[model samples]
Target: MQTQTKTQFDFIIIGAGSAGATLAARLSENPEFSVCLIEAGVKDTSPFIHIPFGLAFLARLTHLGWSHNTAPQQELNNRRLFWPRGKVLGGSSSLNAMCYIRGVAQDYQRWSDAGAKGWDWQSVLPYFIKSEKQQHGASEYHGDAGYLCVDDLRHTNPLSQSFVNAAEHVDLAQVKDFNGAEHHGLGFYQVTQINGQRCSSAKAYLSNAMARSNLTILTQAHVEKIIVEQGRATGVQLHINKKTLLLKANKEVLLCAGAINSPQLLMLSGLGPKEHLADQSIATIVDLPAVGQNLQDHLDVLVQYRCKSNVSYGLSLAAIPTYVKAAYTYTFKHKGMLSSNIAEAGGFDKTEFAGEECDIQYHFLPAILQDHGRSNALGHGYGLHVCALYPQSRGEIRLLSKDPQGELHIEPRYLSHPDDQKVAIAAVRKAREILAAEDFKPYQAREVLPGAEVQTDAQILAFIRANSQSIYHPVGTCKMGLAEDPTTVVDENLKVKGMSGLRVVDASVMPSLIGGNTNAATIMIAERAADLIKQEHSSA
Candidate 1:
């Protein structure tokens, strides 16, 4: 018997997460392209990965995520926040709240104006439609035959609905569809789900393509670095099964390792800032000054309150009967409390400091989340997460050490800009108003965060600085723009500038953060990238 190991591929995609998985499935459709998707984590076999409510346990299960911690953020009380990116097949889609949102048209307009040619709203909207299997049926703005499922959440807590109603009471319009015409309004979030199960990118894109002979999926393979020979990326050097192997890509090596890892991989491959590489004794191959620059993320703060009604998703001895019934419902029907995505209801609204339309976003959770749900707050309480959508602060991801698998110096520089603080205060105030509206007065509970005594703006800002977290939408590390632009790492087509045969097809290449959950947009990018690659290789 002879052992067989495939070392050559027409296209090699690193990180079998959202973009990688979508690219793998789409690129391999022709059967002429030999696509290899490499994942650093194990298979997405954990039951928690599929169940919608299982996300509460996912944060504690460190094995499913890349345990990336930021350097002490000076603006955030010098606290080093825990930033979790998925290591599993679907990437963060497997771990996220599954809120499916395609940012307003203005978001892509920013991409176009920023010199990302051919990436305007009108051009990218089709890809969003092409990638989704919308439950509302096909229309000018949505598609029904696509692989990715976008449907109304199977279960929503009554308190979640109350939040939306409260928003209406506060004069925010109620929008039936955030992805429809108007982007401003409050409503129950549509989720990436199917039949009460989480429809992660892996499930939507990878599952059907798993048996494709042209598509090869390699899990538990950590890519040490990209192989760039004479300024052109050719393959990947990786460690799998305790053995090192150099897999060759005859056409292109797509870097989809996401914002943090993608930049880290580039720096390790001697393709980052010349000065930074020199400090690590890395011979600069491209001297791309912006490889890890231009980092952006949404800084979120929770405005929580104790629930007088025992409807919140809190664990307690008093709530035993409700949970027992919930378990029975989930086991028998697969729809109930178990089907809920904690951040069930949310809204997109413009603050007074608004730029292009909206500047603030909200997530109303039926339960009070403490420390990203790692700590069990066993009581009846609900929390609303308020996040500044557009941040003025830009940070960078740096190599902490020369080791390929070492820790990264992740610094988001949250609240470094004075403008972000203003948005935070406004966002919290807006959330406070909605929670205090007539609809919520019935279930009125005492404020738990920034109590009634903390009334002034200065106090609110202080509370925000001391207790804020990443909404997990980190982007723009490997920014995309015109090649002449000093800040751009990738060009409009996502090709790494100054380096041939390499492209970044992940959130890292985003020029700026879109104003919503990033999972859908990331998938849309992959959809478009797959089409581009297909066009480029049509004759091959």
Candidate 2:
């Protein structure tokens, strides 16, 4: 048998996702530190990934995504939801909808209230601003000097603008910046783009940082286990080209593999639910009961409609000119419909009775989305993708087998909560009302999904149960809270409980789901975690 050589690093970051990339870039900035970042997927070099409209195309190219599907959801008419995670250098940030949202301030306050110190809105706001290079210039809430470039929607379609106008028609307040003083209202979405191209975390944070000789990035490398010694994570075992490589961590080993993979990796390395690990004949290390529990995700139901004119993404005789113009504009000026995020306009509004921040969000689309891609559309139409902001349902990610090569079992358990169903019904009704407003007269023809006949809460609920799918935001697997809380996996500082030289810094550590797109929030977590690590090191 041949033995593999072992290498070492100051910091070993698993999964080059949003959080890991940020940590790697920041931690490696100091000349004294040497960091190794490993990603399971190839480098993000696809041109489609950079194009705004090309998301629909890139989503179909399964090579770049981990297209995982959940078990049959009993509440959602037994439908399985498709969860696509980016398997590239930037992770999901490379493949996301590009909507830059900071979520409601209260969401972060809840984390501080729940024992996550220094995670309150005030403390985290600086990190949010630090991660953004807002095109709107610097302000109290936004910073001009940052890695992630945020540009307001450069080109919006007629329907998208009309939807915003209809929001005003229905008395929905409009805010200039959702990440500013308030996040409640309808407005144009700010996107993570530069020169009409998507600026994923890899592009934003790593492109320049990787130039440093201290930062080592290994793409197409999958981490198989966190080598632990007496309850301490000391290194990692990686698989590359069917060969195993042992890399030791001298300072710390960070798990930024995301919500699903992070917990799954922990379980694989004998640090999850004791009972499940025993069943798989794997020895338990930490026996964390909530390692994979507290799973949460937003499930959206697409309410589509047909239009009288050629307004949909569907190419027609009359709309060819529009498509041509859009293509030319994007090709020349890097603007136009080609630069539009399909889910261009949407907002957060609280449904009366929910105590927290807005419990529902709306994603408006100007095209008929028969499938995730526009390939299977049924003519010119529009749709509204709506879902509850907070779901009561919980699920788990357990190992399918003791084999490190096997995929983890994932059950999102969406729509299990009765309130979730009620919220969906209300959102659909609100969307209908918006479509019926006078502002929609020029664009609206008829309601296609759940049509006009499918009225009443019962029918809407049924439709929700039948069609609800994930918006691809999943978190809280490795929750962060006090040690007394058995469910908490990490402390407020992101260090794993009862473990040394290890931390889980990513979306997985979120104690509660944020109100909007989580990409920004996850990057912020990484930024703060890096600082925390530095502070601890300096003090040491």
Please give, for residues 1-540, the per-residue lDDT of candidate 2 as tens digits. 223343888899998989999999988888788899989998999978888888767668888888887877888777777888989999999899899988888889889888888899889999988888999899999999999999988877788878788777768887667788776777778899998889899999999998998888888888888999987899998898778898999899999999989998888888888999999888888878889988888888777878887866665677779888888899899998888778888887777646857788888888876556726554687887877888888887778887765767788887677777777788887778777778778765788788788998898888888777789899999999888889899999888887899899999999888988899999999999999998777534
Instruction: Summarize candidate 1's per-residue lDDT along 299-408 as a digit string, tens digits.
Output: 99989999778878888877899879988998899898898988899988877899658888899998878888777887888888989888999999999787878999
Error of 1 at 423 (Å): 1.0
- The lDDT for every candidate, in the order shown, is 0.90, 0.85
**For model 1, what is the error of residue 159's alpha carbon versus the real structure, in angstroms, after optimal superposition?**
0.6
Top-TM-score structure, candidate number: 1
lDDT of 1: 0.90
Give the CA lDDT, 0 to 100, for residue 216 in model 1: 85
Candidate 2 — number of clashing residue pairs? 0
Models 1 onward score TM values of 0.98, 0.96
